[model samples]
Target: MSKPVILCVDDERIVLDSLRTQLAAAFGDAYIYEGAEDAEEALDLINDLNEEGISVILIISDWLMPGIRGDELLIQIHKNYPNVIKILLTGQADEVAIDRAQKQANLHRCLSKPWSEAHLLETIKSGLSKL
Candidate 1:
């Protein structure tokens, strides 16, 4: 079987690179890492990966991106792929949005932007532990 995937979505290429780099370093070859610049692209990627028989185990998305906001995106993803863990990484999401995602998306965690590598890894490990 293909390795499970961890997807990171952000409008900034630099942020995407940072997330992938840190994930690869911490996870080694244990999971496939994917990136999407926006919610529409993320959904398409998710569908494509699913069709390929690759499981998307986790998603870490930015809340302030253009197009679909992270909370809404996670809720939509949860409706279709309920078992996939969701994490919102943002510096700008309001409490209402965070709470909505927590309830509707079964969101695993919400980490602030300019995240620390240690905290990010810890969040991932914690989320993965429940799977």
Candidate 2:
């Protein structure tokens, strides 16, 4: 079977590239890393992966995007894949959105933009440990 996937969604390509790089560096070949430039693309990618029998293990998304915000996208994902760990990597998400994600999506953590690599890794480790 293929390794589980970790999806990162951000409108900015640079941000997505950086996140993918960081994750790949930390986790190596243990998981598949994917990126989407928007919520629609992320959703499509998730569906495609699901069809391939590759489960998505985690999602890291930015809150301020062109289309759907992180919280809404996460909430939508939660309905179908509650087991997928959710983390919001946003610099401008409001408390209401974060709280909603926490309640509705079981959000694992919310980290500010320009996030510290160490903290991001630690958060992912702790979040995965719960599984």
Candidate 3:
């Protein structure tokens, strides 16, 4: 069977690279990582993945991006891909944003910035299991 796919969105390239490496190491070939600098690109990739019959089972996104806030991006994702688990990784999310995202996207969890590698891997595993 094909491996599960995870879509990770962050404006910082370093964060994206780190996540790709770490997730690959932890999961081996069990995940397909789709990284994007902004929500628009992520949306495009999600569409392509859906067309290819590969649904994104999880999304890990940052909140303070340039084009779209992480919560907004996840909300959009929920609109089309409601079953995909959504997570917000940010250091600056306010209570209002969190509340809105929780209602709109059913946000699974929020991880603070500079998250521990172990915690991240564990959270991802749990999120995927719940899906």
Candidate 4:
């Protein structure tokens, strides 16, 4: 069976690279790390992975993307993949958006941008524990 996936969606290439590096260091080879620059691409990836019988265990997404916002994307994902853990990593998400995600998406956590590695890792570990 294909290994579970940890997907990160961000508009900025640097942020995606950082997340990829950090997640790789933390989880090693146990899970696949995938990155997408936009919500549409991320959704496509999710669909493709699912078609291959690869489950996406977690999603880390940014708030202010070009197309669908982070919360909306998470909400959409939750509709079909409620078991997937969703975390929003944003530098400018408002309270209303966060609240919506929490209520509608079963959001696992919301971390501010410029997030500390320790905190991010801890959140992921805690979320994983719940799964």
lDDT by residue for model 2 (8-116), tens: 9999999999999999999999999999999999999999999999999999999999989999999999999999999999999999999999999999999998999
> Estimated TM-score per prediction?
0.99, 0.98, 0.95, 0.99
Minimum summed lDDT over a 10-residue window in model 2 is located at 122-131
Which is superior by TM-score, 3 or 4? 4
RMSD of each: 0.5, 0.6, 1.0, 0.5
Error of 2 at 125 (Å): 0.7
CA lDDT of 80 in candidate 4? 97
List model 3 lDDT by residue over 1-131, tens digit each.
55668989999999999989999899888788889999999999999888888879999999999988999999999999899999899999998998899999999889999999999989988888886
Off by over 4 Å in 2: none
Error of 1 at 94 (Å): 0.5
| Total clashing pairs in model 4 | 0
Kindly report which residue pairs in candidate 1 clash with one another. Answer: none
Q: Which digits, one per residue and each the tens of the lDDT, describe model 1 over residues 25-129?
A: 999999999999999999999999999999999999999999899999999999999999999999999999999999999999999988999999999999999
Report how far off residue 23 is in candidate 3 (Å). 0.5
lDDT tens digits, residue span 1-131, model 4: 78899999999999999999999998899999999999999999999999999999999999999989999999999999999999999999999999999999999999998999999999999999989
What is the lDDT of every predicted structure here? 0.97, 0.96, 0.91, 0.97
Model 1 spans > 4 angstroms off: none
Model 4 stretches astray by more than 4 angstroms: none
Candidate 1, TM-score vs. the true structure?
0.99
Task: Please list all clashing residue pairs in model 3, or write none if there are none.
Answer: none
Model 1 local distance difference test score:
0.97
